[model samples]
Target: MAKKDYYQILGITKSAEEREIKKAYKKLAMKYHPDRNQGDKTAENKFKEIKEAYEILINEEKRTAYDQYGHAAFENGHSNNTYSTFTSSSDFSDIFGDVFGDIFGGNRTKRAKKGSDLCYKMEILLEEAVKGTKKEIHIPTLQKCKKCHGSGASIGTKPYSCSTCNSKGQIHIRKGFFTVQQSCPTCQGRGTIIKHPCNGCHGQGRVETYKTLLVKIPPGIDDNDRIRLNNEGEAGSNGAQSGDLYVQISVKKHPIFEREENNLYCEVPINFTMAALGGEIEVPTLDGRVKLKIPCETQSGKLFRIRGRGVRSMQNRNQGDLLCRVVVETPVNLNEQQKNLLHELGKSFNDFRGENNSPRSKRFFDGVKRFFDDLTR
Candidate 1:
């Protein structure tokens, strides 16, 4: 008999997004959950099918292979050997320890563990972002103990092999007809236990200390960008390698300029006289102020681009351009003489035709006429 199609069972197309696939799987799983359909064999089988589909689709590598080659991608053999291995795995107690250690605690290996990664958020002025600068940072973390050489034992004593598991580090148990392996509870799976705890570290082999490091921040870094410093984190316990320090960048708000990608944007206010008559004005840049040319009859919100005046790309691209948006400023606090002059200027264009002179206005009024005509008929 032919097997059912996974996509058809999920009720989604081949080009469905990741979120869409998850939504479809969740809907089917909730409707056919085993506890909800206890006596129905059809619903139980459907629930199993949904579980198998999610187990494949949720994994990136498995989903890619299945999409390209179908179910044949996972047919290494036709045996229950894989299921037997899973069923005979460790019990919940030790399994929980190993999983939670990775999530909350640390590694369980006998060797020294790597230090934790550190994040530092550094703020810089816009001028500093234009040009690179070096700075110092102080961080407090756990440093390895120096008294007992990070061994967590007294000067004359050392750790001994665990007696519970006989130094094998794992215990075996028989359940029904299957044999399973579980981590040793006596030594916490470290295979060794300290006889006399160290006085300096209190048996942890580490102490709290503060460290200061100097970091050179490069130019062109934007908000949320990070610089990684290798082996600059807290000292590892015993002889393990140290982790890394990540310096996150944050640019302060500038009064004149706003950044977008690699480009800079600024609003330049121009008097109404300048909008009517052509003139040159000085505009500000990261380096200094430069002159910009405005044409006659320039309207408000007109944009002018200055080449090579923006930020350089951190990813090795050439410098970008700075864009200036012009905003026409009307004169305020005018006296009677200024108002009369403006009224005289307006009277010169009072004979302007609304149809031939303004095509946009004519088109809008024509559309309104047709709408009312259609409604009346």
Candidate 2:
């Protein structure tokens, strides 16, 4: 019988990209693998077909020849015979690991272990976040044992090659036509065994210790920013590379000012006289206080912006504006004379009648009247 098209066997088009071809092959190979579908001869045959299709389509030269002459290109021994026979489980793992290593952490062939990364949360004041500061932090982590020097062996002794796996760190198990490779149970993939364990850290090459580090925070760093310190985390086993330490920053809420990006916002309460007559008022900024000029007849909830009085940008050193929202505070605890004077002032405004000084209040009352009139109509 004529062989099926490679693309059709892998359920992909002939114009499929390399990534698409690999993805389809991986899916089908996992689904029909003999190890996963044990005792099913149909699945075993299907897996072989998928593997053959992938092997040809993934290679430029083989694909070119196969595209021109189909399977007849390899019938009389023209092919390299790379995949003609399945010899060992290592060969199967090599092909599978090449495509899926990143998805499954890393290649299983690599037995060296790196130290685990660590995270530390540090809270700072808003002022500190804007101005930048240095802080010392204490972290409890694992450090390499001084006596054993991360080797896990006692004085005058060193680790020996694992007898179970012959120091290769992996063991192969053959089941029928399929074979599986796994880390050696005795050495745990370390490829070495310690006869005399270190007294300082037992068999483990690390000990619990507290580490102190000084972290320098950058100016204008916002909340939830992360600063990484390289190789400051737990010590790696067997002399592998150490991990990193990530310091996460949390800015505390300020009582007066709220920050949005580089800008600063604050609600400033002003007396009714100042709101109406206009005056210079003091507003707080990250850099001391600044005077903000309020225009005459300024209404409540009016915003006044002071340029270059806000937080500076860490990237470019550009400063932002400070926005002050004015809230008119009503006079309270008035004496009898003050109350009478206010009453007279209020009457004077009404006596002007045609002036319409309070246009917002007039428009609001007009809308209310129209609503009631519509209801009556």
Candidate 3:
């Protein structure tokens, strides 16, 4: 008799994905498995058909040949003769292992687990962030026991194989038609038990102790940046690999300067005479004091840019510019003689007339007059 179509046998379309094919096979295998069906001949035949269809379609090379030549690709002494034979119970067990491994913890191999990671927050001054510095931090963490060398066994003693799981670290429990594997209860999946525990750690293989670590802060590090120190976290159990430490940095506020990226900004107070008449004045920078030249007729809120006087770049060695905003200071608490001299100076400028000495104030008042006239109209 001619064989049935593979896609029709699996109840899937030719365009079905590999995962869909596996899913359909799993569903049918569960329903018609010989173990589930007992002595039913019809279910056994149907299970064989499903298994044969899955074997051909699951293999890329066989599926390609079957798609081109149909069932003839496996007939007449072809290398694909393996699909004609029904698989044994061992094959079903391998399939079950692949499908239910994660749910039942069926992995047989045992490996040591790494220690847990740790996080530490460090606060530093803005100056320290701008310039690199080293700091030592003290942390309380789990360290491997010195007396037992992380084995949890006392002197002249050792760990023995677990009796519950026979040192397999896992136990298999048969549930009807399926076998579920879980961690051994006695050893907690460690596969061994310490015969005599060390006095220091009491069978934990680690002890809580204070450790000092030195961390180097890189230059030009901004606030909220992080530095990772590998293998500096809690000690691992039973000679496993240690975890890592993360250091979070926070920069403090500066009194005189505000930093944005690589630039620094500050406001400088300038006398009214200096604004009216050009002069050189001293200003503060990160490096030291520097002379700033203010041109004649300089107004309040005028910004001055000084090259290479700002924060340095972390990636490259390039320096940034500094921005200084000038605010003209008004004279106050004048004596009688000073007031008389100021009055004489003000009279010389013809305050009542349209004098251009204070051009900004004159234009502002003229604009206000025009606004009022328009409102009346």
Deviation of model 3 at 157, angstroms = 4.1
Q: Count the backbone clashes (under 3 Å) in each candidate.
A: 0, 0, 0
Tens digit of per-residue lDDT, candidate 3, span 1-377: 88899999999999888778877887788888887778889988998899899889988999999999998888897763553322455455545655445334457534256788999999998788887899999998998889998888898899999988788777776666676667888888888888799998998788999999999999888889899999898889876878999999998888988888988899999988899998999999988899999999999999999999887898897888899999999999999999999888788767733446888778888899999999999
Q: If the candidates were sorted by their TM-score against the true structure, best first, what order would they fall in?
A: 2, 3, 1
Q: Any runs in candidate 1 off by more than 4 Å, and if so which?
A: 1-110, 166-168, 175-180, 351-377
**lDDT by candidate, in order shown:** 0.75, 0.84, 0.84
Per-residue lDDT of candidate 2, residues 64-181 (tens digit): 8988998899888797666552234655564455555534554454345789999999999999998899999999999888999988899899999999888878777766544566
User: What TM-score does prediction 1 earn?
Assistant: 0.64
Give the C-alpha lDDT of model 1: 0.75
- On TM-score, the stronger of 1 and 2 is 2
Can you give the lDDT of residue 128 in candidate 1?
A: 78
